[model samples]
Target: MSDARAPASVEVEGLTFHYPGAEDPALREVAFRVRPGERLGLLGPNGAGKSTMMRIACGYLPVPRRRGTKVRVAGLDVATQSLAVREQVGYLPEQVPLYQELRVREHLEFRAAVKRVRRRARRAEVERVAGLAGLEDMLETPIGRLSRGYRQRVGIADALLGSPPLVVLDEPTVGLDPNQVQGIRTMLKNLGGAQTLIFSSHILAEVEALCDRIIILSRGAVVADETVSAALASDTLSIEWGRPSSGGGGEGDAIRGAAVQACLEQAWSRFDAAGPLEVELSVVGDRVQATVVSGPVALDELAAAIGAESLAAGLPLVRLEPGRRRLEERFAVVTGFREAPERAKGGRS
Candidate 1:
């Protein structure tokens, strides 16, 4: 993934996978790289391939047989050097697998043994992870007797075994209560880049809170790969507009509704290519204002183009300011859950 002395923390290239007898591939030409010590969040709806991708990266699922696909962990190929990759990854799946009869401490010790920790050092290793997961008090309690939150902590502790270089967690906070979720999030945050972390969750807030970078998957394709700031910004621009002159000295109110929308469409049409913008129009007192948002775009160039368009049409441009889209809506546009504003007659998208 890079020329650095250490290989990428995790890497995927031209990855595509299909379940047996499935019509559509679960993942389609997906490619991304996770940097060493970075926290990456995988975000998508159900069946969006988030879990499948994680499984493939963890070596639990096989990479496609096709030649173009490659999956690697810590510079080791997952398809060929899975044993070595396993040694470098600690994985927690959507469902926690635990032996109900075993106590928390015993479960961790067994996992450490399975991970091949040295015989004499397994107990000390188990204690270390338990403390990180806040499971010291529950270490002696049988897993079946512990609360759901405690059980989740046990699963996390198990994954932390051996201090693997890459830690992959799939929906680790799915069923936990608010307090439980907060506790687990804080614990993982405290890891502080000790190991690279890749996690998935349906909760956008949780993902934004825990990850410095995020990769959004949609219908098996990589839709967005951005740092938290860039992802949320969505390159929004808010403009305050005035009515264009109607071939006379006085400004006309005719450009209030559809005319305003047409002005925008025509302005954007001037460019060779422009990202689709979600336009929202509102009237403050007697003034007409619009909030426009799009994915990454050339703000300075666009602002100039838009200004030129307004001048050409004799539409007085009152103001041109930049703003951010609502956090959740930034995702909606890319995920196809919502469409842009359809009208300017006091209508909002």
Candidate 2:
């Protein structure tokens, strides 16, 4: 990577920080880089130092006593050019502090001025960002009167004031309706190419959707830094298949269910014969549900084989489709967090 001219937009080496009266350090030798145009998601359970790292990156917290450890933002030393580093970053905190008395337009205009936007183009810039954040309609409305969703938009608008290349957003979509979440996601995706974004979220779905890469933290250290595809590569491909008959007879339903079960058993037997294998199959409704835990197989292949074998026995192929991967299951397996049966886990997703 030496000849690569440091693809990193932000770099940190040997970063460690401790809080007053804390038994352990909040960050310990945390080292990672945010490459130019990379949308990196920081993910962790509660109290995993994700927020601490964000604070350090935003210059809200100071480095430890050891000096010259090396932290840089936009090629400026975070230790020395602290003010310059702050000037180049746009930070959206989790609480989203804003003056409730100010109108949406007034709040954005005030932030732009604080960021030293030029007098001639400040209004135009404010309007452009307001539109970008979908705040155009509420520009004249008081912030306190806006909904939680609109308040979030105003916070995002404030962060974009100086046209900073690096944007750090914390829990940008915590309490929004589906439509509001969609709007925020669309805006972030639109900004992906022009800005280097580092967002932290406890919601796995959000990270999977918005981030090109993810850095999962556990116990105040980096546990995983990989693309979503890489993180979920070992997931099982669930298959469901059923046979249809001329009429909806009870016998036909039973036969279809039995055939699907037989197909799954046969597949598992085949896999076992090929190698040491572990799999699971069961009946769900009129179809058979199967999960092959060991090796990866394509959904089409599993469905096609089952369909062909069923049709050879004079049964009509009814339905065949792939099931979505359960992110919680994959997380448990990868992170070694053994969970009870999903239904038994308080029935909360």
Candidate 3:
């Protein structure tokens, strides 16, 4: 039985699943909760069980009767009351499924009927969702003739037919054009405070923009779970400096690198009372980049220490930035993909 006073809009406990002939479980003891009206993002590399988890949450996959998989939607146990749980959730799978032959309005109306929305209320509900998804102008267009963006919107509208409290979207903007992505992002931003949203996306910036909190999955297990603010507020200092003009040859470069390393080590030693600090130094072209990883420390203090030490070593500092660790970088580090894809100069599109 679910607790009547449960504060979460969605809850999962000890959830695990395996395919009939698979050697390992697709999901292993995954657990998390979403409070009412909270937007959460799920991130992971391929085969990380993100889609699997979303499927279970949407009741598309059933939990084994004796496996003790516990999931609830809108305070209703999903395994025990699948239909009721479905009524409280709007799910958009990675692949937007739609009836190609049907018009947008026709498809939404059909979905509303299948979801058992009252006959008299179905039209109003369809219209409301259509408006929300920006399908008002193309409501009568055949779905097959619509663009991918329009098709995604139709899928979203179909999911929203019954005003479900929890909306789960998997890769809602995958393969979308820049304009289309922005449109969907705007819609989702508006929906955040009004709906309990759980979405998964490989686009780190998209997740950062739309989610309040993020849960990162790795090898079917939760690896990193934290608020967007905290995740972005990493305790690392980034320093960029100009390399010496004479440090062109390999030997010169090695010597310069060692000097920079020594400078950082000396600066870090100033905080001997504070724990250990790790430094990673690399030379990109003629520029030197140094990253100092340590526990939470004042950015200004650390920057001052590094500046003073570099001056003593005759190393020229170009820029010092704090908390520049991006969400994608953290994701890569946690998931063991240390070489995270670099973002373009301006940022993700």
What TM-score against the true fold does each predicted structure earn?
0.74, 0.75, 0.75
Task: Please identify model 2 stretches exceeding 4 Å from their true place.
Answer: 1-8, 65-68, 235-275, 282-289, 295-324, 330-349
What is the Å distance of residue 224 in model 2 from its true position? 1.6
**Candidate 1 lDDT, tens digit per residue, 87-201?**
7888899899999999988889989989888888889889988988878899899999988778878889999888888888888886678987888899777664788889988
Cα lDDT tens digits, model 3, 202-262, are 8999988989999999989998889998778756678887876556767777788778888
Q: Name the better of 1 and 2 by TM-score.
A: 2
In model 2, which range of ten residues has the least summed lDDT? 340-349
lDDT of each: 0.79, 0.71, 0.81
- Number of the top-ranking candidate, with lDDT as the measure: 3
Regions of model 1 farther than 4 Å from truth: 1-8, 237-322, 341-349
Q: Write the per-residue lDDT of candidate 2 for residues 206-245, one digit (tens) a residue.
A: 7778888888776677777787766655434455555354
TM-score of 2: 0.75
Clashing pairs in model 3, backbone N/Cα/C closer than 3 A? none
